[model samples]
Target: MANEILVLGATGKTGKRVAERLQKKGIPVRAGSRQGNPPFDWEKAENWATVLSGIKKVYITYYPDFVVPGALEKIQQFVDAAKNTGVQQLVFLSGRGEKEAEEAEKIVINSGLHWTIVRSSWFMQNFSEFFFLDNILAGYFVVPKPKALEPFVDLDDLADVVVEALTDDKHNRKIYELTGPELLSFKDTTSIISEAINSPIVYEEVDMDAYVNTLRDYQIPEDIIGLMQYLFTEVLDGRNESIKNDIEDVLGRKSTSFREYVVKATQTGVWNIQNGQR
Candidate 1:
């Protein structure tokens, strides 16, 4: 029997790619977004019951992140509802080095639904598809952590691992710490970006307070600024430097590197749009 999978955050970075990959593989995917029929909104309860009507499995990617406000409460509520609605499996996309995220994982694990957790490192796409894009386009990549090294994982690998967990039962109850094959400093990561795009992109390091101030000046939400500060100071401080073999363990191949991500994204013209040359 083909399972119906509900994908929360269906329009976001990893969720979109996972949904597309599933569809291409002919998996039945119900895109759970505010725009879809029987829309799914994390903040709205009425929409939840409708979206999980026939969903036997769920790929849970919390928007913004899993550590944000009321996320644990919301996740608990969703799990209870999913159990009542008879959801058989649950896959959560989580962040590494987050205690709150770990707590949320525990909630889902004990939710009476089969569960798997993908604890991810910083995404390689952040430079090209996320907050750093504007900075890169403007010819500089400024960051809060000057000395932090990240094994930035590729979203393609993440999507693949997610699809495997959703479709196959072997991955049930396992926690996968997913990271890239090489550890690179923010400066080194940006250097790859420069080489891939054939342009010189500079990396500038600033203190967390300064970065937070800049975010405030830009009118970024206080909650988001807090999270970014936490991630940089608390999570990125030499804790995730060692490269892991989890990708090979899960997907039977070497994980994608920073350079690979830059090259592929550049070829896709995403960087061109960022450079304002489009």
Candidate 2:
């Protein structure tokens, strides 16, 4: 029987791309989602065994955020289940400068499963696909992060590295710290967006409380708001300034630049389509 790989959070930003890339390489892939057949749900332990059946490898991406409450325990439980189910390898999509995420990575490392940790900084897609999209379309981006300079990693690059780790044994037992080539503050990031979209876009640095209130006004859940606060206040406190060469080491090339990301995202009609920007 051919080895089957399970991709957790299959519909998410990175997971979607990883599934596509793996399928393009003609590898068997099982989309592990609540909606998929033999569905997998992180909150539902009953579905785990069935979804893990016949899966030799896994690309684990926890939804919302990995640093949220109950993530570490859930990850440890999943790791145990995967190992017991005869899974041979695992690749986790993790965040940079997240102590909780690092602890979760440690669980995977000690799981006795061949593991590769893709610790990524802020995603470049955050502007094009996630929270920042609405702000970009609104002609102004607001956030609490002002001085933080993040080397926003490209989702494409992250997905490619994940595919590599799944198909090749060379990446086993390694932690890949992925990020873009250049550091850019929120102000600089807005400038890049303006340049790419050929329009004037502004960035406003509000206090952390104001940002939280804005999210509250939008009816975002409290837990998610807490996660955002933790990221802006704790994780982005100059903890990830140094760039790593993991992209070059794993993919044998330099990581994508933010300028390239802006241009490519523009071409994808990401910024061009202003409707439902979120």
- Work out the TM-score per prediction: 0.94, 0.95
What are the per-residue Cα lDDT tens digits for candidate 1 across 1-278? 35768988889999899999989988878888988777889889767888898789999988666667788888899989888888999999988878888999999989878999999999989887876776677677777865568889999999999999998999999999999988888888878787877877777788888888877866778877888888887888777777788889999999998888887888878777445532
- Whole-model lDDT, candidate 1? 0.85
Model 1 clash pairs are: none
* Model 2 local distance difference test score: 0.87
Candidate 2 residues 136-200, lDDT tens each? Answer: 88787789955578888999999999999999999999888999998889899899888877878
Off by over 4 Å in 1: 216-221, 273-278
RMSD of each: 1.9, 1.7
For each candidate in the order shown, give its overall lDDT on alpha carbons.
Answer: 0.85, 0.87
